[model samples]
Target chain A: MSHDAHVYSKSQTEYEYTRRVRREAMRGQVTTFAIMIFLTLIAFSAVAAGFSEYFIVPILLLLAAIQVVLQLYYFMHMSEKNHGMAAFFLYSGAILGFTLFLTFLTIVWWN
Target chain B: MDFNTKYTPQSWPDHPEQVTLEGKNKFLGFWLFLAGETVLFSSLFATYLALKNKGPSGMEFSTQTLFELPLVFVMTMILLTSSLTSVYAMYHMKNHNFKGMQTWLAITVILGIAFLCLEIYEFNHYVHLGFTYGQSAFSTAFFTLVGTHGLHVAIGLGWIILLLIRNAKRGFSLYNAPKYYTASLYWHFIDVVWVFIFTVVYLMGVVG
Candidate 1:
């Protein structure tokens, strides 16, 4: 099976173009990292500022959700092609996780 | 080609990590494992949330008095930056720049070690303050959840460091490309879990 593989060298132009594209993608990843940092700052400051728990909790969760989405899509390359099965598995786990959260938060805390 | 196949920048596949059947299977299998990790962590988070702050009748060690924001904030930034460094490493990997990739990964390992040191210090401080793992349900839950994440960080560091050493002379190949790719993905996933730990565990713990 290994012998079936073929290696094709790119032309100079093709190599340069791919390099440029990857650099741009790397730049996008940096932007995502910046946004994640901004979100973390907001989360920390909102608590440090002494906001009501009711108001802060939802905002914190929302910010965390947004940050995770960015991490998964940009950093983890879920935004790229050929991730349908990957998405399916992760989302299925996520759905079940959400269910676990709901159940535990409700049932376990009951007096 | 096989592991020993040599290629120049011009010959390197665009997605060298996914260029082979083995690489493709590894890619898919790793994601499946990550999905399982998600479920496992969610169970832990749920348990932590349900048991948070619940203890004996006169428990005084609540989240408000226990968690320190500045420390957590620093840890968060370190882990987040480490995630980006791994991204940079992957970028170099894609560009077929072996030295660049190794340098960035080394930077990532240093950051990860820094983060792990902070966590150890934080846990030691907690233990010193009578908040040992057996102190209360809250303490137990807190330690378990956060400690589990710390373990992941440790494992990730070991994995990347091993890869760096093993591939030092290997240069780049379809075989090792997928290994590096999956390791970075694991590192990013660690950062993803930290985002929640900071928000739900530390930030919200402070608010209440």
Candidate 2:
């Protein structure tokens, strides 16, 4: 609310440091968007050429995977050194997800 | 809705201690969500492949007969641009620029609506050519895959509208920041899903 820049006392310097760190955290979201744009164009081309359906599916899937990682690493900031254990729990869902897909596909295809 | 419950608190620290438990949990929770979404789409993708070659009356009325590139190209661009704008919004949020974030998010929302219109038009054109979803398994799969993604877009539009309205008065704080963050994540997630939908549903149908 104050028009003037609020100068921080040395004792309360952590608040200023926190604000700066938070600012850095936000800027990294841009890279995630850049990768998303690259992936989207590839998707558009696949839709355009009308020739790469089978090949394109996997490519797009891989890009989705990459974007997922991008979101986690950048936006979510989950890859910090202390959070390694938590990463396993997150990846466990990814493993379970793959299992679910393969199981459902097999049953449907075999039936 | 004032989301100020203890479970969903009124505010949180803009930056917390390095090993804060809550932030770690949130990060993992979102990852799990992305994983679940992956499985959801994979199942849809599998169903689509099974039905791709199955056309009407044993004759080939599948993707090749129905898919159009020009319209799809424009839709693709619309979605891609929306992704860029949402990123800009997030960038502003990081810098504590609430107005810039809102401005960008508004643009992203409009682009999302435009893409939805393009999809609707594309579907109508396909149906006019006798490629309706009820026509066959292929059409069923086609409609389900793409339609599900469309539904996501619709829901996202509604979600962003709520976010815009709710946050209009309240600027960027820790509580609202994560709310915006997750909403954008969902938006980007939908855009990514469409990428696959375009490939597996439209491209494959035309080629195979």
Chain B TM-score for all candidates, comma-separated: 0.99, 0.86
Lowest lDDT 10-residue stretch of candidate 2 chain B: B1-10
Whole-model Cα lDDT per candidate?
0.92, 0.68
Q: Please give the lDDT score at residue B163 for candidate 1.
A: 97
- Per-residue CA lDDT of candidate 1, range A22-62, in tens? 88988888889899999989888888899888988999999
TM-score of each: 0.98, 0.73
lDDT per residue for candidate 1 within B57-157, as digits (tens), equals: 89879998888899999999999999999999999998889999999999999999999999999999989988899988888999999999999999999
Model 1, residue B61: distance off in Å is 0.4
Q: In terms of TM-score, which candidate is strongest?
A: 1
In candidate 2, position A11 carries an lDDT of 30
What value does the TM-score of chain B take for model 1?
0.99
- In order, the interface RMSDs are 1.3, 8.4
lDDT of 1 at A17: 94
Clashing pairs in 1: none
Q: Estimate the overall C-alpha local distance difference test score of candidate 1.
A: 0.92
Query: What is every candidate's alpha-carbon RMSD to the true fold?
Result: 1.0, 6.4
Error of 1 at B144 (Å): 0.6
